[model samples]
Target: MNEKRMLDDQHFEQMIEEESICTTDNKVYEAPLDALYDTAMHYCPGCGHGVVHRILAEVIEEMGIIKDIIGVAPVGCSVLAYNYLNIDMSEAAHGRASAAATGIKRVLPEKYVFSYQGDGDLAAIGTGETIHTCNRGENILILFINNGIYGMTGGQMAPTTLPGMKSTTSPFGRDVETMGAPLKITDLVAQLPGTAYVTRQSVHKPGNVRKTKKAIQKALEYQKNGDGGTCFVEVVSNCPSNWKMTPVQSNKWMEENMLPFYPLGDLKKPNGKEK
Candidate 1:
């Protein structure tokens, strides 16, 4: 009886030690108090950009890289994303964020460089720049927000627009006969040998938000390692204002339609694990 009681006490002590270690790790990962946007954002209630912004902010704060980070903002609804993020940022001309980021990183290699681009910009106009940058192994993080439509340009059909998806330009739904299939940017970019990490995630739900944060952190950590390669994150975001649907409906569309077309999770990791 005494031996059994002693065994139970040992098990209890081991549980306590494990709990303490987990608590310490959680504290270490706690986000900074000043790591969020200062003002109320104008994004719609169900807009995925807000969730992405918050996750980026938290990752920046948790990693303590804000002081050394430089963000390049692309043109679109996220044009004003620079104003919201409390970090050093530069605005690039429409669809030229990767080029701008390339220049910045070349001049300031020590800084953590990143470019935030949209589907229309990255998969369409800036396709050449995006491909070359990744191919050349530019040490930059490319946060590609693929909402499947051109939000700023009145819901036009973008390169990432899925089949049967309707946009302002495709009022009758995207026709694979002429419009072509949706461009899976992450999958395409992952094929580039120079790319160190490539992942696709969404922010339509709470569980996804957590996963998105980890993905962002992985990209940032890859940059920190001076990987000398591209880290691409294709985020499946929502545009309620342009989609002609309520915020909730927009999120539902993302889950019901978007996920099947642009499935989430890591497409490639050079090291075979999160950085």
Candidate 2:
């Protein structure tokens, strides 16, 4: 074959190989974790909240804990999570999801209870409830969605909002001189004696999605094993509309800005194992 033709063929072969890997990865759904419902989510395109929702649903289905699971939905975009998830759910006042979940779990210790909360709700108004629940070692899962802004409430500033980040309330960027620094709930709660598992994960990419699912599954497993401790999963999500950015830009911002402030990994785990 001519040298030019050989180069062309090599290029074609590399393209084919790349395509194959992409196809295989797309098809490789974590068998043990599959969504129970269809893909018609209420969230906007490129919303990390939707991805986390799907992951939790898949985990619950895989573990066969749907019937025994009770979820407490907090104020914010995820307040409507009950509309998508096909399980028993209760709505909680802003930032009081953990308290509500604690009450329910105490009444029904055999049931698997979980709370879905947003950054504003979990870190600000609901901070007290969350802290006490974790400190008391409530046997419940806390799926904390930190999008860094009040998504449902017109893009207001949240306790987890990054320094110098612009929001509706902080139009000129959040000033630490007045607004204070972003709250790192995962690190704070992990220090509590009642915390059994504390992980910070994201759904910004496919690999991160898989890791987030595993973290959630581990939290549920810990609860099933009679480990009466707080299992917290802080998902650094995105709010494209609230942030006034396109979906792609929102994702890029999460990787560049959010990751720096809230680094992802298993912050605290049982047996003192490193993640």
* TM-scores vs. true structure, each candidate: 0.85, 0.86
Model 1 Cα displacement at 159 (Å)?
0.8
Candidate 2 residue-wise lDDT, 154-241, digit = tens: 8999999899999999999999999999889889999888989999999988899989999999999998886649899999989999
lDDT of each: 0.87, 0.88
Clashing pairs in 1: none
Question: Model 2, residue 128: displacement in angstroms?
Answer: 0.4
- Give a tens-digit lDDT track for model 1, residues 1-275: 89766777779788778756666546655433465657888776677888788889999988988899999999988898877898899999988999999999999999999999999889999999999999988999999998889988788999988898898898999999998988887788888887999999998887988999898998888888975379998899888988889999988988899898888888888653442
Q: For model 2, which pairs clash?
A: none
